[model samples]
Target: MTSTPGNSTEKRQFHGDLIQLRGDRAAKAIWRRVPLASAGSENSIDEVALQEMLFRHADILALGEIDPAYRNSVPVCMELGTRAGAADALYLTPTGRIVLAEFKLWRNPEARREVVGQILDYARVLGSWSYDDLDREVRNRTQRSPCDIVSEAHSEVEEHIFIDNVARRLKRGEFLLLIIGDGIREGVRDIVAYVQEHSGLRFNLALIEAAVFRRGDGEDLIIQPRVLARTELVPRTVLVRKTILEETDDDPLEEHEPSPIEDENERFWRAVLEDFAFDDPEPEVPQPSRYGSVWVKVDGSGFGGWGLSFGAFLNRSQSGMGIYFTWRTGFPEEERVFDEIVGALSSNEELGSRLEGWKRWSAPSGPPRLGFSRNVEFVDGTTIRDFDEAVGWMREKFNRLVSVLHPECWRRLRAKG
Candidate 1:
């Protein structure tokens, strides 16, 4: 191998050569030492270069191969959030899990210890955010939606479902946290153990070591990456929210093939979609989704901070129809507008009395989907005739949502469009 001006003390060599041994045997072949490359300077493998290489050849990481269920995903974003230190990369796993990663070059002993705490801090901060919050932050940092970028590369992914899955994982902090570094130093394993022992976080942490080498010019660089620490042996921590894996058979949201009953429900919603009309311009029609939600959207209204929407949700526990406000977080006066509409819905006596059964609330965190819902059962035993009766009730709810309940907001929203 060609040599560069690097410190000889930092190099690790692998040697081999093919030679004919005349004295030992008649015609014996032997291989001598073959020098590969040197480790080079103290900051030879910097974090930026390390991160770039990993991002370029992420397949080399082979995350899915390590666990089959974790397939069909790629790194969706990098350098999320506005802080001194932030997560290096974010990945979307097969089942919509968030794979949080941190790349470090542990040249400084003090930095190595601090990095462990730093990653945990990142995990905690991320865990507190909703999927909408994450998507918003990712877009602000990278100027593109996480799902949009990933979906462009992987067409099979259903953007809405994929996003929902990611949101769910974030809520539970149940994604894989991979800490990758070169020269992680000794006693770091104990620190990982100490954190795991005391924390209630529900994430998988893996310490990966990357050995970078250069043969001849830097163009022919090689990096060998391996897992040095893993959390598989660590006992699972119970989180306040039930993980999708832990839900019992009785779960209404459990993934399964669409039953005959579900087919009927789909047909019913399709008929409703045909009959329902609104003032918004060429509104996006409601589509069938795996999660038993029928969604409708006004196109241009989303240009501002929020959009106007309608939805029909079906499940065992509660089935409902809602008039929605898709308020994204981090927009101008987002919280004020959201709280204003919610207050209007509650205080308007005409709307309140007529829609006594309908409850208004926003999604817990992130870009909240503010909604006013009316529950109805279309699956259990309700016939088409019964559904017809429910239509009148739904029509009244829709009419009131438009005519009452802060009608000026809708007018202003349309004006913005």
Candidate 2:
């Protein structure tokens, strides 16, 4: 990320309050930072609780945002016993990449450095193992059945291929390392510099901030995960062949340095986020859907527990805005309201004209989409102004959508919900 005149990059942040609406009750929840320490008895969010919270909500790690290919990831185990010590959490992606995460609440500079060292040590120790060794350790530590270990997370991976891939990764010292803290406050430049100084190490590193917002009763919780910081990009790795040499039925390899096309995609989204400015009735503060997310939740707000977002799609070839018929599959009445809204939008002349050139794409296996969109291209020589113009178009149209649908249509639906 180089600096240019008049092109300052803002520190990415999750904006707005956590508003919860349950059973027609709308209670605005504030962004409550995790407490430092309890005054008396003991700390409420001890290290154990933090780990449990993270383990329970793996989405907090934002692995999908890091790499779209990591979609079907699953936690392998917690407190994975390593030669150095027990790492807080471990995950396995469908692509056979091992994601090791460690939880830390760093108050001082020294604690930050120590945590970085600990994470490196964990990665180093884990890097030095045979497939049998890694599998045996996972089997011994994990409460889940040994047979379900790889099959559950990645059913497509045969046991032999899974076994061989792990062995190869161990030999190559290739791993994705994460140093997670509760609402990271320190400047990321310093942590990135520290990781950069230790470039000899063979793993990609990232800094994540996991912010937890809870309701009064604590039963309802929302975790806003921010990649908050990143040190470097990992070479995109895909599950291709069992091994490079001695080809059998498998393809040779699906490994390569990150391509320029991907770099273009990331850069385009970053520009849109920085230049986002809405008009008319101001909505809630918007935030990136996730780390390296291609889209943003422009609505920054939702009614009936549904969000309206606008983002680049199809490798930046298309972009649009839409919200799903949320909570529709379960509660029949709520689904009715959402379905009615979708149906009304299609027939309502005023709303239908505004939605011209929009698309609602759906698949049998995936949720149905209801969006306003246009085809776009990010080919060679695409400028920052081009990115800004796209966002401006989205912003203007979104504002119009809000003005039309918000109070009249959305409020009515909210009342029914």
Which candidate number maximizes TM-score?
1
Residue 316, candidate 2: Cα error in Å is 44
TM-score of each model, paired residue for residue:
0.50, 0.49
- lDDT per residue for candidate 1 within 96-155, as digits (tens), equals 777778887665457678788888888777666665567678898778878777777776
Which numbered prediction scores highest in lDDT against the true structure?
Answer: 1
Q: Each candidate: how many clashes? A: 6, 0
Please give the lDDT score at residue 302 for candidate 2. 47
Deviation in Å, model 2, residue 109 alpha carbon? 1.5
Worst 10 residues of 2 by lDDT: 315-324
